[model samples]
Target: MKSRSVIHVTGAMNMGGTERMLMTLLRMKPPWKSIFLTYGTGTGTFDQEIKDLDGEIRTIPNPGSLSDHFQLFRTVKPAAVHAHTLFQSGIPLAAARAAGVPIRIAHAHTTADPSDKKGRFIYEKLMRASIALSATDYRACSSAAGNYLFAGKSFEVMPNLFDPKQFKRPPEAEVLRLKLKYGWTDKLVLGSVGRLTKVKNHAFMLDMLSELHKQGIKAVLLVVGDGDQLKTLRRKAEELSVAELVTFTGAVEDPSIYYHLMDVFLMPSLFEGLGIAALEAQASLTPVLGSEALQPEADLGGGLLYKLPLEAGSAIWAEKAISVATDSHKGTSDPVAVPPEEVLKHYYQLYRWKGGGHEQKTADYII
Candidate 1:
């Protein structure tokens, strides 16, 4: 039997939440092959992993360019094209429609605009309209994401699933060793994992750290992941006079080690689809402090997740972070579980149905 081809479009096959979730799905070795179309240089932290899974990754120099999209769609001739993008999905969706691809899935992964680039809002408005006309199905990581892109239109909430076991708290000795290796000894360690982008609101984290310092709280912050905002964030930390207390450990393959060393996790995003890093923090038995703009569903009903409004300022966030770090009973041993296989099965079934192929029985699967 000839396997169906499913093409995945994204900013880049990097360590971001969307890319990581797609990589998890690829691990199942499903019936159909996976092809990735990235707007970046095509090289990322997951490049080797995708290649190891026999998945193909191609780069498009100019993403959201109609010509490039049309050409790629024509070349792939895939049965289905699954685009995991933010607001700018219209180009690929239109191209997929033009190529006569049976299934065109526009998967929205964010509820907030991560960039302040000029013409972003206007472009998103146009793209949103185009997506409505071209996409056959809409998918999002959360209700917030769906509502942001599809609004009242029907869409599925596709949870970003991962191996829950990998996130569990490691041995105390191991955690201590990691902290020692990173020179973070005898300090209240606050951590965050995500691209150092403006929408992520990392600069606010620096301000919060400065607040903690003012309160005479001895703490250190470890940031995981890298992006255009790294330099800006570093400069901000210096200006805030908290440079020595902050550590930016550019993107890493596994965040489990870092999560283990954190006394509390922080996410001060301006907006979010679902905070995967917060979820991972909870799994590691670390408390999370998030901003009000984040979707409430990110809490996953765990008592450890705390949300504060951005207007509340970094001082309030710092106070809460201090409290959470000191509270011993806050961490949960049983974190919200996301069985990777179950998520993969649902996606596979969705792809099959969209491709006009035989659908699999998956009545038990839940969003």
Candidate 2:
């Protein structure tokens, strides 16, 4: 039988949970063929990840306007459409409705938009409308995200999936030993990965780092990912006198190699819809430290979860770090590891379901 075309639409082909999930779906052969949509023209880490997975990419740069949807509908004949990016949700959904796709899935990865309050509200309303208009179902990685995207609507949960196998710890692991090149050898390494932005609370992380130093804990921070706040964050590190200990790798492709170097992974963020970096680190078996505002405990099974003190001072924060780091697990300086095979199997099931459509679904359960 000819395979159905399962088209996925999104804003950017950036390295993120949503895009990674799509790449995973495209990796395995299923009853459906896959295509992608990007509002922007250029590509980054994701394009390579997709190509490595043997998937195809298509462009839809002008996806903001409804007319753009009409143009897209004419260009790609898709059996179904899955929207991974929030901004592009309404347009592709509207297009799917016009094209009469049987299954349209709105993939929500975050609890709320940490960008702006007004923006978050607007997107929430748009997502609701999109689901009501085009989607057969709504898929979320966490209840926080599901509740926000589907206010009155019902939603399903699919935990963030990571192929534990791809991150196999190397024999002569250089991810840690390389840190010595930056003088992080003697000091403990507390690592965090994500774009340096306000929501990530890099400033707060620096604050906590300073607190740790003042107490003579002898620790440093290794951050991955580059963004607008990179300069400001570096400045904060310098101002806090922790600059020598902090290293910003500026967004690498496979962070798992880096995850091996950490003494403890820290994610002190204002909020998180889905923390992919933390998930990758956890699957790599790195001990984690997260802000109370974000549910690190729920997502990460065994990790040191900390809350910013209500008093907000160097003393309290330092005390907290000491407590967590002492008990933290950092994956043992790159011990040998083989990733699980089911990472591919899990994705195969999803693609299989997408290709087969409602025919494979049991009508009797009616859930």
Return the top candidate by lDDT. 1
- TM-score of model number 2: 0.82
- Model 2 misplaced regions, further than 4 Å: 1-3, 27-31, 117-127, 172-176, 296-300, 303-315, 328-367
lDDT by residue (58-130, candidate 2, tens digit) is 7765767766766666566565677876545867787778776656778777765665555776766775676
**Residue pairs in collision within model 2:** 110-273, 111-273, 164-339, 165-339, 165-340, 225-251
TM-score of each candidate structure, all chains considered together: 0.92, 0.82
For candidate 1, lDDT tens digit of each residue in 194-223? 777787888888998999898898889999
Error of 2 at 9 (Å): 2.5
Model 1, CA-based lDDT = 0.80
